[model samples]
Target: MRRFILIFLIVILCTFPAFAQENYCKDKEPWKEWDKLVQKYPHNMDIQMLHAVRIGFCKKIEDSTITFEVASDAFNHLHETVYKKDMAVKVREVLDEARDSV
Candidate 1:
């Protein structure tokens, strides 16, 4: 009986991380779609802005410790182009919000 209980406890502990990750992914599902859109329209400022906002929203919803690494990459891409100054500013604002949330 003691061995059975120990095995059951070990199994439950091992499954906990998977269960938590599943819930995290469910909460982050919308962000995943936004990421896909960003990939599809790599140069579209509007889509990038949407993606940044979604990242911020996901950060808020998940109360995650994660930072806006992907958003930072997009911001860097936009920053490289002189023509996208205004759009870069907008994306930067959203990324800042996401960073602050973390």
Candidate 2:
């Protein structure tokens, strides 16, 4: 029983950050634009992953209010993920157009 309680507490602690991150940049300007892009290009894995990357970036910074400039910086500086060159270029172009509307 004691071990079960401890495990439950540990699980809750581990999940707290996920919940915190979920709300970090949701429903904001760039993300709203991102959502539309995601819907428009549902088959584009690059766009989907880029959305995840931006959300992860926002979570890493613990910032809820993300602007286009901040997202652009994150998108440009990502070093860990390798994407298909042309698709990545297209995604960035679409992102830039979205920024204009925001």
Candidate 3:
């Protein structure tokens, strides 16, 4: 009975991190839209950085508000620059609305 309880507790502890991470990017309204943008523009560095910021999952240096490291070499080769420019403008507007809604 004691061994059964110990195994059950260990299994529960192991699954906790998976449950916690499953919702890592669903906290804000902008994040929901941003996830779609990530799929649409999979190679845009700016959009990727915004996603990282929303998830709190990027490396940063001191005294820097606009500089950080993304965890991919693909960020170096950017695509959809002109198209994502329009999407970015709309995202900013929606972000402001989300902020006000909260």
For 1-102, candidate 3 gives per-residue lDDT tens digits of: 323333433453345345343433334654565577678667766556655644443233233432333322122222233235545666888899999999
Pairs that clash in candidate 2: none
- Write down the lDDT of every candidate, Cα atoms only: 0.50, 0.56, 0.46
Q: Rank by lDDT, descending? A: 2, 1, 3
Error of model 3, residue 6, in angstroms = 55
Per-residue lDDT of candidate 1, residues 30-59 (tens digit)? 456556656766886645764565456446
Most lDDT-accurate candidate: 2
Clashing pairs in 3: none
Candidate 3 residue runs with Cα over 4 Å from true position: 1-28, 57-102
* Candidate 2 CA-lDDT value: 0.56
* Model 3 TM-score on a 0 to 1 scale: 0.29
Worst 10 residues of 3 by lDDT: 70-79
**What are the RMSDs of all candidates, in order?**
20.2, 18.5, 18.4
Best by TM-score: 2
Candidate 3 or 1, higher TM-score: 1
lDDT by residue (1-102, candidate 2, tens digit) is 323333433453345345444444544765676678678667766566767886776776565466545654555544123333544655888899999999
- Candidate 2 residue runs with Cα over 4 Å from true position: 1-27, 63-74, 79-84, 87-102
